[model samples]
Target: MRCRASARVDVSEACNLLCVDETQSEHRFEEALLRSLHQGVGRKPRFFAVGAAEESFDERWLLQVLTVAQQGDMASVEFLVRSRVNKTMQRSIRFLIRGAVGRFGGRFTL
Candidate 1:
């Protein structure tokens, strides 16, 4: 009986269905986040700047990584953490250099 039931299931089709479900769930979450942000203080200049930066940011990818982490995907979490750390370090270095040049009355070059 189990063999008969298993034979009726197409593995590829099942995988496709699961993928669709996951994609829909992610889409819903993204919409909800956007709605909440809009309803909140997303229109103010400060918040708008943050939102603009974040729109260019990979929030979706971060969300996926976080979800995977919650599911115990340690490797994905580690990679994401390392990537974030590197980005933060680079931004900090740039900010410090810019500040130093500004303090010395020198033009900061990228």
Candidate 2:
């Protein structure tokens, strides 16, 4: 999830499983997303000065948040909208506002 190597490994494993059985592609894709979402703890703050903050470039949490919105979770949807206007990291804020929304293909709306 953090890098191409790990993502490749995950996809390879999922492909192996599918080849051994007859799992649907969508199911396998969702399983892969869930597996990645629940991986190790996200980055914690590394303070260098007062009020300094650490930004999480992790996309798994991003997908999880967006997925929640896509599933009709009001609170999470509100959070995404709020985050779009806040001082969130560029990576996450862009995804929150535009990128991931488009990826959701109208399944989720702000």
* Model 1 lDDT-worst window of ten: 38-47
Off by over 4 Å in 2: 1-57, 79-99, 102-105, 108-110
Cα distance off (Å), candidate 2, residue 11? 31
lDDT at position 2, candidate 1? 27
Model 1, TM vs. native: 0.27
RMSD, model 2, all Cα superposed? 12.0
lDDT of each: 0.34, 0.39
Candidate 1 on 1-110: residue-level lDDT in tens? 22212222222232233322322433323222332221122221122233354543444543554455445565765565455434423332222222222322333222
In the order shown, the candidates' Cα RMSDs to the true structure are 21.1, 12.0
List pairs with backbone clashes in candidate 1. Answer: none
| Tens digit of per-residue lDDT, candidate 2, span 1-110 | 23222342232343345322223334343434333332212232121332346534444355556677566574775565455333333333333233233333434333
Please list all clashing residue pairs in model 2, or write none if there are none.
none
Structural similarity to truth (TM-score) of each candidate? 0.27, 0.27
Best by lDDT: 2
